[model samples]
Target: MASVLRRKAADRGKSLLDMILKERKFARSIVVLVFKATRLRLSRTSHKPGSVVLISAKICIKSNSFTRLVEAEAMVYVSRSTSIPVPRVYSAFEYKQRVYIVMERIHGQPLSVDWVQRSSTSKAKILEQLRLVADEMRKIEVPEDAGVSDICGGPIYDPRLPGRSHWGPFPSISAFHRQLRNGIVPDDIRDPESIPQDLRELFLFHQQLWGKPVFTHGDLSSLNILAKGDEVVGILDWETAAWMPCYWEYTAARDANPQNLFWREEVDKFLTPNPQAWEAEAIRKKYFGDL
Candidate 1:
């Protein structure tokens, strides 16, 4: 049954025991597990099929590492509020070589950019909904279950640097810059180094100083955030979740457009995570009328 289910999931671009789901010596799964000696199993599959019931160890064992992280995270936030939008988490347990996190399988539409494009006239309404989620999220407290050290991890630049990696691009900021300059990403704005000192500083500022540090969906890309008629129903893909500054995922990530352009429909000067901002001059200027 397990093998059959795994095969079925794979056909749908979803897989239990996915390639990304690393396995252990016992052929079981592992979670934030430090030592590989333990594995987890779901104790019970509640009949009603709500998130609280443990589905099945065999099934849970098939989850990927990223799923484990999300379940563990859900365990932390579930206590806060059921009203707010988020997947409900039940457990994070380890047994032999496996780790399992039980969660309420959310029932809602997944986020897609199609709606954002379709709702241009009502863009502000959509943004407002996003802003509300952000506001509610800012209120949630990090759970003691997941340790801070485990969540934030290490700093990228200068082992000597403080806190964490630069929010945008890191290790080699220049690589991202080169991509931007060479038109790696379409509709990119900003003029590399030639940018004014103030704007340059602002570009750098966004990297470091956007949002309040909280648990963030690090992979809050278009494909990850779900929606149903403009209402953000669920946030998928917890593999990239982390405790970090706020807007990096929420504000900056929510939209792929020149944010300044949305309001007043102006594209004055923009900045992205790339090393040099001036990569795609033609397209960038076409929107702004001038780079």
Candidate 2:
């Protein structure tokens, strides 16, 4: 596997592992191991939570190309473009239809865990910091030459659509909304008609509003946020991030399952008022019936 990875890296120009390992002074400590998953696996030999280096691997079917590459690039892009903190990517390489990324391992508790103990003031401060991060995300501008309204849309490169590639890069918000009901119906909501048409209509109305492309963290769930005390030390996971419509980030955050009442209320405090939750629920009903 090492020889295969090395050859594959050479084909891409240079060995990212070779270069990055040297730079990090890893020397010979690096080990490649696997975990079980349909599409991805975590490296078992990961650094301790606060370690300066960590590695991850994703081995997918050949058609998947290199989604891990997209993830690494997104992290690097966020680190360079925003005040938001993300693990620094040391290297990313594709070999034998597998993708690997070496990066910093942030040491912090999941915000979901920390939020339970946080005082109101600390929670408020964290939300404020997130608001600033959101603002910074809005400042990211993709070149017009990219020729797509949704830069991270479709099968070209989005971690969200793993099994398929030709999905979107929608030309308009309405176009994206039209495809929202693609989810598989959950057992509880198997009846499509149970989802109110009024809700669907309301969602579409909001879709007609103006939406400009901006960088967005595709998943802003509490688990993805790493916090120490009152401060956010890291925002983990960037595979779904893309230059999406301005509302995408807030919408995703807003729509995330609220694990408790405090989180339910805090969410409202952090983002611009949008009807994303309604739309997302409506879509969920349509596809995965009430899931």
Predicted structure with the largest TM-score when compared to the true one: 2
| Residues 1-291, model 1: lDDT tens digits | 755544343332212323333332222232222111112222232323222222233222224332344346543553364345655443455554444554445544544446435655454555566566555555667544332222434221111112332323222333323322332332254556555555444445334422234555544444545667767666654544555443334333423434222332211111123323233322333433331
Candidate 2, position 263, lDDT:
54
Best by lDDT: 2
Badly placed stretches (over 4 Å) of model 2 are: 1-67, 145-166, 181-209, 257-262, 276-284, 287-291
All candidates' TM-scores? 0.43, 0.66
Cα RMSD, model 2:
8.4
C-alpha root-mean-square deviation, candidate 1: 12.6
